[model samples]
Target: MPLDEESPVAQVRKNRSWEYAPFVNYGNGMGGDRSNYHFLSLGVEAGKVLTPTIHAGILSGQFQLAVNVMPFWQAYTPAPHTQTFVFQGVTYDEPVGGGTYTGASLTPVIFRWNFLTHSKRVQPWFQGAGGLIYTSHKFPPDVLVPHGTPGGTSVWNFSPQGGIGVHYFTRPRRSIDLGVNAVHISSASLGDHNPGVNASIQVQVGYTFWK
Candidate 1:
C-alpha cells in the first residue's frame, strides 16, 4: 500500500536546522584476526542539514548532505599477537602487542547517505567521517614498526572510519539508531611512524534529533 504523503517522515525535506546524534561504537576485532585491539567508542554528532532528502537511484531518500562536528571517546587493550619470521636463516618468534590505550577524537566532517521511503518510522544510512585523534600513550610498537617509527607510536594519529546504520523513529523528527563501523588509526606518515591498527567491528547505538 502507498504510504501517507503527508507523513512527517515522508515530507521532511532537509528543512531542519540541526541534528544531534549520540552513538556508541563496538569494534569488530579487526576482521577476527586480533582480539586484544578491539575498541569501544562513545560519540556524538552535531550538524546542519545541507540538502533536502532526495529520492534517487535504487534507494529512496538516498541522497542527503550534512556538515557535522563529531566528538568521540575510545578505549582499548593492547594484547600482543604472535608472529613467526625468518631472519639470518633462522626462525624467530615474537609478540606483537596492541597495548592498552585510551583516546578521544574530534571530526570536522561527517557525510551521511540516507535511504528513505514513505515509511515514517525507519531510515537507513551509510557514512564516512575523518579527523584527528589523541591518545594518552603512544600506540603499540608493532603498529608503528613497518609503517611508523620502529620503537614508538605517535600520540596524535589520523583517524578515518566508515559504517552503516538504521534509525527507527518513535515520533516525528526523533529516532533511535543502531549500526556497526570500522576504524583505522595511524599518524599518516607525519608523526615519525605510520604503523596502523585496525580496530575490530564496532557496534553503535544512538539517538537522532532532526530539528
Candidate 2:
C-alpha cells in the first residue's frame, strides 16, 4: 500500500523515520518553592524512531531517541532583596538574588516510547529525559551574608524529568503535541549550597513534523 493511503495518525507510528517539533512550556514550582517560582521556555525537539514496533496490547510501542534544545529559557523569581532569618536567638540579614534569570538548556537524551494506540488521530507517549541548564547567575539563589557575595549556587545545573503526552495528527505528517512533565533540578553538589527547585510541574505544547 502507498504511504499516503494510510491515515494521518498511522503515518506517524508505522516505521516513521524522523520527528521534529518546536515547543513551548510553562511550569510552576511544586514543592518548597511553589508560590515564588515559575518557568517558561521555547525549544525544539528532533529525533528518530530507533526500533520497530514490539510487544502487544498495552505494552506495544516504538522507542525513540531525541534531544530538546531551549535557547530561550527564563525563570521568574522573587525580586532581589534582603531576607531576614533567625537561627536560635540571633537575627541575621541575608541578601538574595531573584527577579528574572535567563539561560539556555539542552536535553541531550530523551528516551521516548511511542505507544500503539490503534486510533486514527491520537498517539500517546511517555518519555524520560535528562538535561543541562546554564543561567547568567547562580540558580535558585542562596543567601549572602555580606551582600555581593556568591550565593553558593551554580550557573550550571541538571534537570531530570519524565512525562506523558499525546500527539494529535491534524493532517498527514503533522501533529499537535501536548504533555505534562515532572522535572527535578539539582546541582549534584556542583556548588557550596544546592538549593535547587525540588520539583516542578510543567505543561508543554508543540507542533510536530513527521517523516
Candidate 3:
C-alpha cells in the first residue's frame, strides 16, 4: 500500500534530500583568557538528509550529515604589547602576541538532528560538529614569549562545537536560518605551547536551499 497523501506522517518526510546553506557568523571570545578576541567567518554548509521521519514522540526527526567550509576567516586581537611573567621562579617582562590573524576553516563532520514540527513553515535543529583551522600566523597569542624569541602557539587548531537553530521557510524549497553556537578552540598539544581560546559564542545567519 502507498503512503496516504494526506497522512500527517507524510508531511515531514525527508529521507533523501540535500540541503545547501550559505552563511555568515560572528563571534566574540569568552572565558578567562580569551575575552579580548573577536572572530568573523563566511562559509557554506552542505548536507544530505539520511533518515525518514522517526516517530519518537517529542524527538521525532531526521538525521543529517554535513560539512562546512569557510574560506574567509579572521580573528581580531589586541595590538602587540609587553607583559610581565614568572617562569621557573624568575620574574621577567615578556611580550604578548596580538594583531589581526587570517585563516581558513573546514568542518568536515557535522552531525545534525532536525526536529519535526506540524507547521510547514518552521523546522528546528541541533548539531554537534568538529572542525580544523589553519591560520596565517600562530593563534591566541602567547603570554610569556620574550621580545626576541618566537614560536609559542601553533597555526593549526581544532574547534569542537554544538549549536541549536531554526529555519523559517519563506517560499517553496527556500528558507532563512538563525542559530547560536558554543565553540571551543584548542591546539591539542600540536605546538610547543597551547594558549587556546577556551570558549566563544557565535551567532549565525543564513539562507538555505532544500533540494
Candidate 4:
C-alpha cells in the first residue's frame, strides 16, 4: 500500500538535510511540588544520511550524522533551601525567587548520531550534549549544598547531558517524541562557586518538523 511505503517515521528518516523540533521538558525527582525543573526549546538540525537504508545491524535503521543548534532555551529550576543566618552583623536570608531559577539561554549546540529504527510508526535514538548556559542570579545552590555555596552560584555554567528518546508518528513527516535526559549544570571550576545542580532525570515531549 502507498501508506505502508510513505509512513510518517519514514518521511522523518528521509529528512536528511534539515529539520526542526520544538520541545519541552519537565523534571522532578524527590518531591511533587518543591522540585520541578523545566525547559522549552527550539532545535535547528542539519545532517546527512548515512545510507539510503539500513535494514539490519547492531543498530538497524536510518542512521544520520545530525547536529542540533538549540538557539532558544528557557529553563526553570525550583530550589529547596531557605535558611537564614547572620555573621559579623550581616544577615543573610535565602530569597523566595531563589527557588525559582528562571532564566533564558541562547544556542546550546548538540552533536547527535541518530539510529532511527525500521518500524514505520516508531523511532528510538540516543544522544549527548555539552554546552554553556548563562543565568541571571547566583542563587539555587546545588541540592547537595542546601545551605548555599560559598560566594553563591555562578552566572555562567556548563551543561553536559545524555538521554534516550522515541518518536511516534501520526502522519507523514510529523511526529511527537517522548524522551528522558540527564542534565548537569556546573561552573567547570571557572568561577567562585563550582557546586552544580545535577538533575538525574528529565522528561521531554516534542514535535518534529521534517523537510
Candidate 5:
C-alpha cells in the first residue's frame, strides 16, 4: 500500500520527536547597585513539536557558589567623657565604616518558545523564567558591638527574576543562546534594614534529544 503525501498522521509523527541542549552564560547585574558576576550552568531540555513551526521545553540549572558585597557606611558616637557630657548636650561628628561578606545559592526555572522550528539551519527563540535567590553577609570586626549594642546588623534575603534570550541552532540538535535576566531580593537586617537588586546577562549552548 502507498501512503498519502498530505496525510495529517504522518505530519504529526514528524513533529512529535524529542530534542535537548546544554549551555553556559556570562553577564553583569543591572539596577540597584551596579555589579558583575559569572555563571556556569548545565541541564537537559526535551520538547515535542506541536506544529511544524512551534516547540516548547523546561530547564533547570545549578549555581555552585558566588560572593557579593557592597560598601556601605553608618554613623556612631563614642561614650560621653563624663555623665555631665550628656547634660552639657555634647555632639560627636566622626562617622562612616566599611565591611565585606560572602553569599551563595541562586538558581532559575526556565520556559522557552521556538517560533522558527521549521527552519533547517537557522532557528530563533524567546524565553522567560523566574526563581528564588538566597544570600547572607558577615559584619566587619569594627562593626561588631557588645550584647546591649543597638547599631550593628547581619542580613539574609530572597530574590526573584526573569529575562529573554535568542537561540541560534547550528545543527539539528544543537544551538547557542544569549539573553539577559534581572533579580530582586528583599533585604535582611540584624539592626538596620535595606533592600537590594541584581541583574546579569546569560549565554548558553543547548542540545536536543530526538525519539
Candidate 6:
C-alpha cells in the first residue's frame, strides 16, 4: 500500500537537527574594567523531539583561546610624611606611587546543558554549566612589593556559569545569540599572593546544523 503523504513518521524523520557556531565574548572583570577581552569558540548541539511544543538537547563548546587585561591596585600611600624623617639613620623623604595589575587565562573544557527548545525562528533559552579554566597573571614589576618579580603563572580552577538570552535565526540553519552569562573562577593566589574573585559577562553566536 502507498504511504500517506503526511505520515507522522516522515515528519519526525525530517525534523532531526544539530547546530554549531563560532562566538566572541565581550564584558568586564569583577572590578568593572571594560577591557576588550575576546575569545573564539566552536559549539555543537543535538536535539530530540519530545513533542510539537517541546524539544531537548545537550550543548558543548571549546574555547580556543581567551585573553584579558585587568587592573588591580589604584593607589598607594606611605605613613605620615615628615621632612626630617630618618630612615636607616639617614634623613630622607619617602615617595608614594600608585599603579594597577593585570592577568589572563587560557583553558578549554566541554560544557553540557539540557535546553528546553523553542519552535520560533527566534527563541529564548537558559542554561547552566561547569568547566575547568586555566588562569595566568601579568603584573607590573614596579607595582610589586619588591622589584624583579616574575609574571605569568598558570593555575587550574573550576568555573560554574549560567545565563539567559535570546537566539535569532537569520537563516534556515544559522543563528546569532546574544546573552549575558556569569562565570566564576575559584580564587587563585600567586606571585604577590593575592586571592580574589574573577567573573565576566559573556556574549555568543551560534549556527544550527540540520535545522
Most TM-score-accurate candidate: 2
Off by over 4 Å in 3: 1-12, 86-91, 143-150
- The segments of candidate 4 whose C-alpha lies over 4 angstroms from its true place after superposition are 3-5, 15-17, 29-56, 62-97, 142-152
lDDT of 4: 0.61
The window of 10 residues in a row where model 2 has the poorest summed lDDT is 141-150
C-alpha lDDT score of every prediction, in listed order:
0.65, 0.87, 0.84, 0.61, 0.38, 0.40
Steric clashes per prediction:
18, 0, 0, 1, 16, 5
Off by over 4 Å in 1: 1-6, 14-17, 31-33, 60-72, 79-90, 93-98, 141-150
Higher-lDDT candidate among 1 and 6? 1
Compose the digit string of candidate 4's lDDT tens values, residues 1-211.
Answer: 6643567666656655345677666665334432465555554444445555565677665555555555555555654455565789998775433444435444345545456565788878877877676656653344234444435457677778888888787766667878887877677776655656665477778787666
Per-candidate TM equals 0.76, 0.92, 0.88, 0.69, 0.46, 0.47
**TM-score, model 6 to reference:** 0.47
- For residue 34, model 1's alpha carbon misses the true position, in angstroms, by 2.9
lDDT by residue for model 5 over 1-211, one digit each (tens)?
2222333223323554454444333344454323422333343444444444323333221111111222221111232222121225875442222332334433434455444333344444455544433324322212223432222443444445555554444444445555565544444443363424344444445443334
Q: How do these models rank on TM-score, best leading?
A: 2, 3, 1, 4, 6, 5
The weakest ten consecutive residues by lDDT in model 3 span 3-12
Best by lDDT: 2
Residues 72-187 of candidate 6: C-alpha lDDT, one tens digit per residue: 21111122222244668887653322133333333233232323333435455565655554433332111222342322222444556776665565545456667677766553
Shift in Å, residue 191, candidate 1: 4.4
Superposed on all Cα atoms, the candidates' RMSDs to the truth, in angstroms, are 4.5, 2.0, 3.6, 5.8, 11.8, 10.7
List, residue by residue over 1-211, the lDDT tens digit for candidate 2.
6654557767766756699999999999986545579999999999998887888888899999999999999999888788788889999887877888899999999999999777787889999999999998888777753656347898999999999999998877888999999999888889988888889999999999988
Candidate 1 worst ten-residue window by lDDT = 141-150
Steric clash count of candidate 3: 0
